[model samples]
Target chain A: MTDSINATGADGGLGGFFQNLTDSIISQIPFWQDVLLPALWDGLWVTMQLVVMTAPLGFLLGLLIAVSRVYGSAPVKWLAQLYVIFFRGCPLLVLLFILYFGLPSVGIVLGSFMSALVGFILCNSAYNSEYLRGALQSIKRGQLLAARSLGMTKMQGVMYVVVPQALRRALPGVSNEFIYLIKYSSLAYVVAVIELTGAAKIIASKYFMYFEAFAAVGIFYLVIVTIATIGIHRLEMKYAIPGVSGAVGKVSKGH
Target chain B: MFESISAVTNSAGYLLEGVGVTLLLVGLSLLIGFVCGIILTLGQVYGPRFARWFVGIYVWFFRGLPNIVLLFLFYFALFPFMGLDLPAFGVAVVVLGLRSAAYQSQIFRGAIQSLSEGQMLAARSLGMTKWQAIRSIILPQSLRLSLPGWANEYPVLLTDSSVAYVIGVAELLTRTSQVISRTGEPMILYLTCAIVFILLNYGGMMIIQYVEKKVRIPGFGNNEAECL
Candidate 1:
């Protein structure tokens, strides 16, 4: 494809090289407009839907698990702790395969989308809970004790005094996990859900233009991640209560 | 599930071989990532303004894209077009390593930054060149501080190595699926696969923790030590 352009650039200087590269890229604009843009637009909608549906559910599940781990009675605490370990230990793609592929054998089949949704929520919440747990632990014991001494029930004290501050402190780590969710949500494709990466794969193989297709897809992912990160930063700043320090040194990363 | 026990047993050798390949992928990539990470960290930390900007963009580009897409880009397109014919496994290793380097640099940067400025100055005052100062003073402490975060890259990379399965690399997950199709017992087989991964996960962490204690300077690391 660019071999001809490369041959011409070989005889020319850097300016000519850049010119040829731009010329080739500019020539492809019509094809990208007519072909890649429309398919990618639809796939993006599916991806956005996945993020919108999963984020809150995962965060809510995360809060429950974190709370239970920090405050629940014996068995409940152990179970919640175990849940975090189990899901966090499992690779999300394999978990998706098990849910989407293996579940039929147990006579509980979920659609591809549902399977991905369940898998992501499980994995996402586990990591989120880890962050939440740290935040919960970082809350001063005096706050909870004070709330209880004020005639507040254990649940009421935790709900009112401890959790709000902890969530604020954990906001950075939680939002970091949120960004990981968006990137890895591309894994949904392995189970046959045609989201963003899946759409790119389909188009690449169809057109036999692997480079163009994947490069364009990379741009799509990069743009969305950039936007999401900026948005999260804004939200984090807005919620930054003056005294609650978002702790440093938390290892919030993704595979 | 019971009958398929033999199938797994028979391919226990195959599966072990798969585990070896998986380890090789993670091992080699992490090694490469570690090397690249150090360079990128130095670039960001001590290099000029342009270098910092370049490192910033590199990290953003690699970290922001999904692993699978990076695999697709390099494997299907970039490598072949450039006329180098690395196997899917090699390409996977390289992509994973380079992507990992971005994450690793940040880990190293954080570690390097955590050291007091006085240490660098002390090394400089002792007639040490910048490289000598870094090698003798900066790296010793920062690498230790960087361990927990750096060790974390193991599990992350281990899980991500599964993405190489998409390229048909005959890794553990690929072998597991092959055995799954043969045995027709997805639950047992997949569960087995999950257990193996979890074992691999903590097992690696155990070694890392051992090294952490082994190399730990007395009265060093963690917040309490930082105040001193």
Candidate 2:
């Protein structure tokens, strides 16, 4: 066990605890500067790379699956449903292990990074399809009927009318998936891809400074998610209809 | 590969032993989480402002943080500071249980909030104390509403129990990995683990469906009908 000092005082407690905590944090700075800092940099790069590559691909694939499930012919719809259930029911880690290990056996060898990317995209697509499907379903049937009555073909109606509304509605959920994707990308480390958590584990093991290493990782995630939240908020505001602002404001206030 | 399958067949008892530990971790953690969830849900629904704030912070921290990171912190960082030297399994149970509790609280809170205010008011009007009203009325209704969500949470917990591998808990995933490393047939071993997880999730969902069907009030067949 370590020292159990009560840094907080009964009266005027702020200064003492602040100083002690500051000292504790500062004492760990060298460890970070030498080892953990570099690992963090590498981890951040890998995580960002995964996010940038996977988000759009996964989103588009999910959109397709959602559309197929909702608007496609019977066979297509069944296939989409099966895809969603199979991927959604299983964990991402298992999916990753299967892709990384199982594929190589059948003469389908893939590089580690590619395997991780494919696994992530597949899993994310399934989860995203569920969200997008719900969003798509939420669009009033009357809206689609109106587009159809306006001389638009089924594809044209969906592309021009249904999709825009569904996309707007799906933004919040997609943003949630994006945040989850960032965290889930850490699982890539199990396959020896040195993402943020993996980097932290390595540094922590090497330096025996688990506190500083993990705290740094947490801060990185918090900052990224906060930025993402603010960015998505702005996007929501920009696309929101003028009259809908009042409704959105009321709903948010209720929450 | 054939040899490895033969090995598995011969060591079926040993493999079962490992599965037992995995189930133990999942079962114990889920049980602890359910109990903690109920308490936290009550706190959120009826407790003072400070209690609500505390519970809010707890849920935010647990949900936002990665479980593996938290497990590491609990095992390597927090345990030493707390002056307790718990074993790997103990650490896995506490960490997973606490994390699951945070998630379960949200589920329970959502279920409780879905109940109409009129029901609580009616119960109180009937001369019931606040706790009495909650115990006699709210809890039963909330439990019913929460079952489906709780069912989903079970599979989530099962999937996440793999995090116990980080702390050397020797769960299914860890054992599978160990077997693969030794036998060099990663495909077979890992695939087996994945199939097992899929079956577990499907089985859990089936059980939830059964429970929901059995306990559903007469004429309230659909979930939304019950909610209404």
Q: TM-score winner among the candidates? A: 1
True contacts kept of 1: 0.58
What are the iRMS values of all candidates?
Answer: 3.5, 6.9
- Model 1 CAPRI quality: medium
Kindly list the per-residue Cα lDDT of model 1 for residues B5-83, writing each as its tens digit.
8767887998899999999999999999999999999999999999999999999999999999999999997776555
C-alpha lDDT values of all predictions: 0.87, 0.77
lDDT per residue, candidate 1, A1-255, as tens digits?
598667656655455546755675688898689888788898899999998899999999999998998888999999998887678777888898899888998999999999999999999899888888888988999999999899999989999999999999888888888899989999998999999989888988997868778888999999999999999999988878888867632755676
Candidate 2 TM-score, true structure as reference: 0.86
- Cα deviation at A197, candidate 1, in Å, is 0.4
TM-scores for the candidates:
0.94, 0.86
Deviating ranges (above 4 Å) for candidate 2: A1-23, A241-255, B1-11, B218-228
Report per-candidate TM-score of chain A alone.
0.91, 0.85
